[model samples]
Target: MVQAQVTRREFLKASALVAAQVTCGAWLTGCANALAASAPPPAASDAPAPIATPTLSRELPFSGWREVKYYDQLASAVVQCAQCPRRCVIAPNARGFCQTRENRDGKLYSVVYGRPCITKTTPIEKAAIYHMLPGTQSYSLGTAGCNLACLYCQNYTIARAKPEEVESYTMTPDDVVAAALKAKTKSITFSYSEASVAFEWMMDIAKVARAKGLKVILKTGGYINEAPLKELCGALDAINVDMKGFSQTFYDQVCQGELKYVLETIKTIRRENKAWLEVANLVVPGYNDDPKMIGDFCAWFKENLGDDVPVFFTRYEPAYRLRMPPTPVETMERTYKIARDAGLKYAYVGNLPGHTGANTYCPKCGKLLIERVGFDIKQNQIAKGKCKFCGETINGKWA
Candidate 1:
């Protein structure tokens, strides 16, 4: 085990920083650990005074939450939706599959903006981003709702909830940026829930965050349409796309989504060269961890996304509708070998932290370039994005 130990209180502190950032400087001690809110509005250029808002410290109104309009009206009074592949033709008062977007009287509004149900400051490594500013903190934010219904959802409590059941607060896009600045975090991550489901809120925040020079990392399922994803790509700094399995049958039966769309999203990220993209494949015990299947996935990734792309073989835990046994550590190691044999340069195991595979090594010299004990960087051998031992160019953002 890598032994990256962090106290629960420290985790709470990180969560507090994330919450304070999302709430626009609103700090209430009692329920402060709840939802992650959006950044507060920016201050006037000439005004020296501080911009402050009344902090309603409640569990509801998760920060970084806001409604958006992404549809355009046609001559026949019909609106074309441009959010996800499931371009839900929502009628007035209807909601999309994610159950967050509401079609109110011919217009669409995201109901779960600013208010988030699942709010916690987790290890950035938990986001499985092994590269792009390693060993730094990211203010994680998300609201309730998901576009796809994966049977093995670890966060179904909030991700699958209706807007009515979860507590929410209103934080504008500016609020999200302000929170990022106040926390002095290395970056902001759209995670814990499906970011694509909250496309407008995430897209808006990414633009503002980029202007402030804060990196935006997306932890997504990669089940989005091309155009909207392309639009968001320009503002994104890095992305971790979940590739559930290698087959369409696995996607259809296990995730209630499509495999090709996710593959397309990964391809778009690489083709556009907009974001530093990584892939995570959650290996369920009996479902998608077959040796041949893993080899095919690694082979495809090597061919399309390249061998330099980081791939994480995440272990599965029983949750949501699926109550299968937890994925074995041996299974993770086995898949790692399969991927490495398939010509993938960077394949790591996750969820069982402290494993040797969690570390990053240079493919050229076979030296440990980055040693991570959980989320903490115990040793770093790379300097300025190159291997220190042999000057091998590391394939990541290394500033």
Candidate 2:
């Protein structure tokens, strides 16, 4: 496993100075004449700003959480959560399947509201969104619990745990926006465990971020109801939906979710046409990595999502309950070929660094557009949302 990287707090001090571009004045605390928020990024030779020690400390653990919307009250003090496809019928003082929302006396409350287990800045590429704002940073945060039960969950330590089961940091919507602004990230992302389980928190932060002229992104399993997803489409700037598998058997036996709901959610997002959309499927060996299944996935994508939306067949790591070895590089290459054979315009193989599969090529001229090493961009040849060489309009949010 890759060693853990430093936290946002335990970061370099000079990094902020380089970010501020204040060569004339510098100090241990911060730099003078900090670059304007609207200032253009520096050249490739210039080092990006190191993470600032976020002075805004985390608040206390979650308690006395607030009530959430999109729930229906039933007889005998029961409530049904309508946020995700689960539509879990919660008993009085009981929690839902995800353990993030609780039903209290016929009212539903999001127990994980304003409480995030992890909050950090990441490259937008890490979200598997290569076409939008390449090389820019995104502020990301996520709480515990997830709607779907993936056996090979990479973040099961938090994802499989209940809200109270894990230590969390309280962060209101204002606090999230403030931290994103402070970090100077291009966008704010709701990621990690599962954003859908923390519906109220994700919506609150996305709305606030949108109002502040900061773009909002969501990395989700696409296991949500239409009403809530439409609301999210209106607020979010970009969304990367995790399409777990192609077959219903795979969805039922492996992910413990329905395949139809995920497909509906993806279609709903595309129908709304409000947010930039991308799809990612974790290729787990002996689960859903069959070549026929991949071909079916590509066919479904072509029919439903067209060729513009980018799709990634990501390398699955050994984690959580699954003891399978890492997905082989040769498997990633086959998936890429499957996508190409399906006439996919922008399909990629993710998670393996320094591979040609990680790069983006123009659909028209077939010239290299973006070269990513892990989550960092090494080269970007798209300008004004078009290929620099052939001037073909790339389908994504370029601004």
Give per-residue CA lDDT, model 1, range 1-399, as digits (tens): 699899865665666556546543323322333332243544568322222232323343323334465666544434556678777777766778888877655666777766555433445676889888888777677878889899888878768887666544445667666655655577888887798778777777888888888888899999888877888788789999999999988998899888998999999999999889889999988889999999888888988988899999989998988898899888999998898788788899887767888889889889988887768889999898889999989898868
lDDT of each: 0.76, 0.81
Worst 10 residues of 1 by lDDT: 47-56
Output the number of the lDDT-best candidate.
2
**Off by more than 4 A, model 1:** 1-69, 72-80
Q: Which stretches of candidate 2 lie over 4 Å from their true place?
A: 1-64
Clashing pairs in 2: none
How does model 1 fare in lDDT? 0.76
